[model samples]
Target: MSKEIRNDSECSKTDDKDWHQVTSIEQIEAAIKKEFSDESDSRKTVTAEVKNDKANWKIVLKKKNEKAEENFASEAKSLKDKIYHSRFMTTIRAQKAERFLAGAAVVLVLVVALVSVSVSTCYEVLVDGENVCYISSASELDAALKDLKAQADANTNADMTEAVLSTDVEVAAKHKVFVETASESELAEILQEKVSWQVPGAKIVVNNGESVLAFATLTDAQSVLDTLTQNAIAANSGAKVLDTRFYEDVTAEEGNVDAEDILTPEQALAQIAEGKEEVKTHTVVSGESLWSIASDNGTSVSTLNELNPGLREDRIQIGQEIKLNKIEPLINVVVDKVVTVSEAIPYGETVKESSKLMKGETQVVTKGVEGSKDVTYQISEYNGTTLEKVTLSEVVTKEPVNKVVNKGTATVATSSRSSSGSSSGVFSWPSKGTISSPYGKRGRGFHTGIDIANKKGTPVSAAAGGKVTSAGWSGGYGYCIIVDHGNGMKTRYAHLSKILVSVGDSVSRGEKIGEVGSTGNSTGPHLHFEVIVNGSTKNPINYLK
Candidate 1:
């Protein structure tokens, strides 16, 4: 019996050693299972002592009641299940929190995008710090201002150097939820009515300190004066100019003026040269002459002649409209000059007694010749008209030759009497009439011949025995006849109704040539007679006998 008891104690020692060798939880569980399977002793108990660290563990075996051991195993399995459930729940909660944060960020971005789309930005225009209008864009406002300025410049008559706005204007950007913007046209219209434009100009002031004309600049005003002075100098082209100046004290004053009041240089010059005069007209009454009309209108006959060209003093009708504007220059240009001219010296006549011809007959011995002399005169003119003239000196260049003629002293028989009547002296009267118009200066023109009034179809005769040089129609002198006598002497009889003589015919003194009539610029039946010597016309009275 003693040997058996010692063997059982040794077996117990081996089991304790096996329990200390277990390192893993599986091995510990397997050992516990094996110990529990052996139900030979129901009171046998197994106890395990676990260390506090994961790397090292110690299990201590002890005997205990079967119910207590079963209860500890159940409790250990429940603790392990609780620990796994706690770790899984912690991981799930962290993932859900991360998704929630991402969703919130997306919603915030959408909200901000919607608000930005509704609100917009625009530009506001202000004048004098007062809001005038709103525009959609800044560029549109700029374009509108430019167009308004150009329109203002175009409306002005004078040149606009620069366009200035009377009020201060500005543009600024503004942010708004709702804004009413103006169109381009509307913006321009508003600005035009609200803004005032100012321009710089100049005025032309006369001696009386009154402004006669206005111009865009001072240079334009000066140009008008310079042109007026230049025209005065140019009038006396060939004369030596002494001095030229304006008659009035003209000056330029700079200031602001109305744009419509400005005048061009050409217009100003015309106004200055032609003084302000309202032209008038006069209707001639019955039995009214040009002289009477001129006297009644506070004017002169010369002025009437100047106004109406081709007007005959003796040919005016009963109902003729005559222009009565006698223009007087606003400024007179006076010029003084010394001029030399050549003048003709008429030759004298000489008579000698001879017996070579019949009684009351004459024959030429020597032809006459004219002389020339240089005459200098001091002259002063106002507005191209002679105001004063004085003779300075006269020098004879060539001497004249007197004409010599032979007169018959013997008498002729009746049968041998010349058909050409006995010629008396050098010339005779061509026609019997009363002198109407004398040969001299007549109303702005020189009368080259004298007019003789008579009844129509009256007898006309040759003044001297000579050949007819010209006959038929002549300009201004109708149905004219010219007789060429010897020694550079000729005679003309105009306004004839009939011609009884032909060209190249040798006519004697008092020979019938033509009949008087009213023709070719003549108002009545008259004879326009002229005497010419050496291609120059002389006073007919001086040579007519």
Candidate 2:
């Protein structure tokens, strides 16, 4: 047997008391496979050596060597297979482990980065060493600092400073509030910037965190406090707006400014006056006096009466002209000279040759001279009411002397009659009377017939022979007679006292037909005689034969 050597100390270390439990067979195999343990075990002897006779010994050695070789070869092959398999499995496990470790490391780094990015910092705002508000963003922190400084400069109270510093500030992902102090305006501005302002019809009606004044246009929405310093009305009232300054002096007098073209209260009132127009008219009513009508129409009674000259003030008729209330026109009276008279001079005769005079040729021997009567003019007085007469100059020329010439002819009241129903060629006055009113239109009515004033019971004679027709009371004619001469000629004597002829009675010229009397609506004793030819009344002066 080979010498078996072992360390007592090592053996004692492996005792039950020292090592109570074994980890695994793999652990034991590793320990036993160590170089030191393998060398020591290799040196251990097996006791009682095998026979070594020459042949027997050779055979035994050969057999043993063969078996040993077999065994060695098998053990080496098994060990080699185990080593290869185990090595491959171990390499795979190591690779998987490395991949897992790398992935875990990467996840840990991402987690650390994410945690760092989400973190924020806080800040406090100070106003003169006094805390105002807290913030968590850089931009907010800056704004807070500014607000705090302003508060300090202004010497604002704690409440006001705090109020000014409080803000709803927004933060970007990279930014955080770093201060506690922020003005209200600054905070509002920050919050406002985050929202979109491009919506249709959207009004950006806020400025510096304050609402802009509401108005139809910007020009109309200016702060009154800003204008108070310059506006006279505001100066008198002493008012301020938006915390603006107001310094008013009550001793200062109010100013007056005329705004004729402006759309203001006073201007509106003045416009009413400008739109007014003046008009005038006249109206006639019952029981209205001329004076009253004139007054109501803004005219004088005399002026109104002059337009209706026939009207009397005490005897006014309905539907008469009356003045109306209205504005009167400004009149400029101008007087101009006018000629109303004309004169003519006649040519008088003087012998131009003696032989012409011997022939007794009287050619207008007495050229009658013409004379002119004065034309009277009148000026109206009493608002052109009364007329004063003015006489125009009269013109006359001396009468020319006439030379006498004689021609022989028979003198008789009657001339020879012709075969045609002609007159004896003589004419005499039909009737004798004085004219009361001449032919024309008098005041208020037409004077259709002439008024011949005559004595009562005067003899009415026929101027020519004719047959008498029936006559009686007509509209305004009484005691009348109509005489029809044979040649479509007729005559009428109206308002007479008596009629001496009957119907179809023949009458001669110079025979009495009636007597003058006032009858049938006659105003006086007068004859209304008419001469009708071919069914028409002819003027008596034109046909008195």
Candidate 3:
């Protein structure tokens, strides 16, 4: 008879059944035989089929069982043994279990003992804000209080009523005291109320006390006030005190309170309380200085110094604030006339004496003194302003003298040069030359004179008729000639190769004074000329024409 066989997929089994079935090879093999056999003979052959199934199942089961056995043996062993053992894990596991339970029991007993033990606590007592630390052994809060009082001193002024104990803190060691420190303000309040009696105002105003009697006299008051102001007291306040008291005995009339008696303690306090002074602004008049402004305001230099510390040492600028200790208002003084003088007045002439004199014309030419007119002035200032007629004298004469001169007719002599002061009038330049250099600074240096570079040895003529003051070698100005042309005017000719005039000799406008040459301080042959007006060098072009 023929038979048909079914595969494992033909069965309706869950994963758990499949896994259980895999665990038993005999039951699986039996199920396979029953499901596949069809006849009696085949049924008999089922045994044979079972035997083959068993052989095939045995190989598969052997692989699965080998892995399971190795894993189970490892799990059942002690952690140490699993790391070290090859197999036979049951004995190691039992031994490991015994050790684990023994350690757990020992730890459990220790924990129970610690949890059941009773511990002693310590506390600090504060009586009236005073900390009193005490060490004691007590279980209850009330018993702890009893132990604290017994530990502290009874004679002390500490009251137990309304006392406060610190938190129930456990004793760290067998016998240890907890400490609390008293606060600063609490201690200060205690000292203030109970320690000592303080006398009011017994302490000196300044710690290293100063003296009032050291300033004994009124002079002493002035000295003290001066010292105080310099040391930082307001200067005006110091000046007020000094001005009131400094000359007390000398200035005070016999009866009432002298200036010395004015500055009492009350007055000094009042002065100090008024820290700043009244700043007085004043418009500066012409010719007014800081010292003058201070004086006009009836205040001293020191008060002005205090007012404007910005300008510590310099003169006060116009329209500045100048504080004043002018206890009384200053009286304004009015002047009826204002005359401005440019030149210095003679010894006998003053503003008063010169006030009545008038601008008179020349009468007798008694002194014949030369006087200047058309003087520049700021006279237009007081025109509409309040001023009387301000007259100024033309001249002041006390003595007079006269002289006579004899003049002869021009002698009939041709080309005869004489030192006659006939040409007293102004003269003109005798010759002309191209101006080579100007009377000023030349390249890299000062020239001091005009340079007229003419032909070498050209006759240099005088620019004006004058008496020769010098005619000689004058250092860098070799063979130079100088002429004083009267009326504080003079002329010079320098770098000359030849000089035709001698000192004290008179020359005409056309006369030859020297010959131009490259004599001294000359790059080339050139006549260096100069014009002096009133002892000062003036531009020669100004007088050339």
Candidate 4:
């Protein structure tokens, strides 16, 4: 018998007696014999027929009243008709068609919901409305643009006050964009290649003029200015910052530099720390030569002689006002302070003859404690350096206990090479000179060491065998060296112009170690010598013999 079939058309099969047009013997046998149940109203029953005439097969999908499903069924049936007609094929199609229709209805609903949910399909990354590329999400495009801007700001070493790369996102249900996809890193590179970033910071101006320098912050520029003013004078004086201001102009510029690229405060101070060019006159004091006056006034001997052409550089008599050129401060920072401090009145030692002690042995019978004295001082400073300190009042607070020491009176084997015999203990004279100043009270301050005034280049020797503990420029002592004799004794050689030994070198007694000169605070060439026993300064005269 001949049979016909409808593709994607509804045909009811609710009852067992209900028949199909493809009920031929071969078609009936091709369908599976089973007890089928139709319980769902949403999923209707359908039949897929098999035609023996020329081996034609057709699938009829019976679906609910749904527009999208009907449209999909018509298109699917058209495709199947072209590929399956006149082909030898057989499939048990009743149960499959019912299940396929139910699944198709659910998928159709989901597709419709999805089409409404997103009017924009792919996230289209646009640069100035020109499509760059498409990303999966709008947030991904935003993240890429944000990363690009941050990197640009960091690369330029400044803040981006204005936007140079304009970026946005666009979405559409369908768009014909033919750009390649890029990752976040690649997107940053693409944006950077297309635009330049803006650099904006503060500029430091000096002396009421426009400055070309731009620092990271206003404080940075201000620091550079303040450093220049503070050191505008000589090494001993100071200056104050004045008329300082910050200039802030935010602009989009290229080829900008970082704040660290500019010179530091120390470097800026070195360039402008010399004060204004001026000459002054200073009256000559007793025992003052051109070199001595220049050293005291922060000038060179050549400058003093040049300022006064007729004045003799070799000899300048007292009461003669010599011309001196010294750098002064731009703004003086003078400090006048009154301070009260307790001074130590050192205990005097007493020596007693003892026969029990060996000839070269000694013993301390009593320990001494330092006495205190209250003193008031008036101090004056130029810049940060102290210029003068005057004692206003003094009062003794306690009387010190005298110390007693046993002395060895027996004759001991000893040798001396010094012409002036001051050595009586364990060392010899460090230099050949008269005692210009003793190790005692001198003027307002107690002298901690003895001063030996000699010629400009007198040789200074080590007082005893010891290792040099320190050797360098010392405060108020100029070029100095300290020798640790390893027996609770240390000797110091100060106010030398040149040092011949190093810090860790070993030397014997009377070994030449330096040359005498007025390098530190002194009126003439001299050697300041000190003897320390058990970390206390003692009379150097006792160690010289």
Best by TM-score: 1
lDDT (Cα, 0-100) at 373 in candidate 4: 96
Candidate 2's error at 481, in angstroms? Answer: 1.0
Best by lDDT: 1
Candidate 3 per-residue lDDT, tens place, 114-218, comes to: 001222234433334444333332233245445444333242222333333322223222321112223434433433232221111111012122212211134
Q: What's model 3's lDDT at 104?
A: 29
Residues forming the 10-long window of minimal summed lDDT in candidate 4: 105-114
Give a tens-digit lDDT track for model 2, residues 7-28: 2224322222212232322432
**Could you tell me which 10 consecutive residues in candidate 3 have the lowest summed lDDT?**
107-116
TM-scores for all predictions: 0.38, 0.22, 0.23, 0.24
Residue pairs that clash (backbone atoms under 3 angstroms), model 1: none
How many clashes would you count in candidate 4?
Answer: 5
| Poorly placed runs, candidate 2 (over 4 Å) | 1-430, 439-449
**What lDDT score belongs to each candidate, Candidate 1 first?**
0.67, 0.42, 0.43, 0.58
- Tens-digit lDDT string for candidate 1 (429-493): 78888988999898999988898889999899987666789999997898999987756777899
What's the lDDT for residue 397 in model 1? 97
C-alpha positional error of residue 2 in candidate 4 after TM-score superposition, expressed in Å: 75
Q: After best superposition, candidate 4 residue 545: deviation in angstroms?
A: 1.1
Error of 3 at 413 (Å): 32
